[model samples]
Target: MNHQKSSVEQQYVLFKLDNEFYGIDILQVETIEKVMDITRVPHALPYVQGVINLRGEVVPVINLRKRFNLPEVALDEESRIMIISIEDMIVGLLVDSSSEVIQLEDADVDEAPELGEQKDNEYIKGIGKNEDRIIILLDLKKILGITDTNEL
Candidate 1:
């Protein structure tokens, strides 16, 4: 039997929420675009802004701010939607803005802090520190409820 360590690769698309930086796996992301009109849906979750016609397909958009219980901010030109596919479901995450993608070595990622029994902590994968900022890496599987791993 041969015992050896295998290298792990991680690619992240970093974006801003509030004043903090966060990232999600690049493989999960489809595309990013500026904020667009989302039709209001009746009896929908507060975090869910509504659905949009993305190339003749109806895609639901989630307000990252409302989901995280952050203060509301007016939608502006700088706002963007990160369209991602989780288990074949196309979801759009509304973010404050967009940023560059980064390749992170495994060593660069650290465990997320336990913030005293906060419910949302489960969605965070870990914390990544680089240069002058700390990026909160998200657990896409958990956040998106992607049970079929093969689909991704």
Candidate 2:
């Protein structure tokens, strides 16, 4: 008898920032929320928009556009906050929009390429190819500057 190994697929939450597409492992995502009141924290990182009371727990919110040094745009109806859990900490990511969940086989992802820039590849985990679109898979831990979740 011959048996073939089944391929495991990973689920990702896809979102848009500027014109580029980005994906994060679905397991890390807690919930997607509409843009709401964010209380600004003084002396916090510029990318950190502030904190919000999420279901009684305070969570820090980071603006992905500002985090990536991209051009800032006004928030509209499509703006959303993706609450994700990283180890012991829960944080919110401000995104332009989150559309769908996609499944990709391990083979569909390619390691992020060296772009010969200072920090261009710092936060990228890999490049995920789906149909004609190339989704930049983000390393949330790195993007959030989270060295130790316990520190949060």
Candidate 3:
């Protein structure tokens, strides 16, 4: 009899941004909150939606659509704020909607395709295959410009 342990699977929080699907590692996500009032900040980056008071902690929020340079659409009922922690910084990412959580083995992920001269693609970690759709896995740290100590 052969007893082999299965490979560990990674979990991801799936969200929608425009018409596309994106996935973020579940470990990085702190919580998901409904769209709330965001206080606008002066002279902030275009992607910075503003700050939100999350249980007393003021968290900076970023609109994924604007960060990705996608066309802007009015916020709807499905809008959500995904609070995630990268390194020691906690930030909120405004997404169209968070649908489900999925698990995938390392083998199911493929390297992101090369889009020459497109700097936006730099934040993509990989493309994950699941059922009939593909999920673009994002490197939250890179997207937020957090450098790992090991990388230094």
Alpha-carbon TM-score of each model against the true structure: 0.88, 0.92, 0.92
Write model 1 residue lDDT over 1-152, tens digit each, in one string.
67486557688999998989999999999999887889989998888899999999999998888888899999888899999988778999999998899877777888988888876598899998777789999987766555665667
Q: How close is candidate 1 to the true structure, as a TM-score?
A: 0.88
Candidate 3 — which pairs collide?
Answer: none
lDDT of 3 by residue, 1-152 (tens): 67486666999999999878999999999999999999999999999999999999999999999999989999999999999998789999999999999998888899999888768588999999999989999999778977777886
- Pairs with backbone N, CA or C atoms under 3 Å apart (clashes), candidate 2: none
**Alpha-carbon RMSD, each predicted model:** 3.9, 2.9, 2.0
Task: List candidate 3 segments past 4 Å from native.
Answer: 1-6, 149-152
* The candidate that achieves the highest TM-score relative to the unseen native structure: 3
Candidate 1 vs candidate 3, TM-score winner? 3
Candidate 1, superposed: residue stretches over 4 Å from native: 1-7, 145-152
lDDT score, candidate 1, position 106: 76
Give the better candidate number (2 or 3) by lDDT.
2
lDDT per residue as tens, model 2, 1-152: 56476667999999999978999999999999999999999999999999999989999999999999999999999999999998888999999999899998888899999999948898999999999999999999899886764677
Residue 138 alpha-carbon offset, candidate 1, angstroms:
0.9
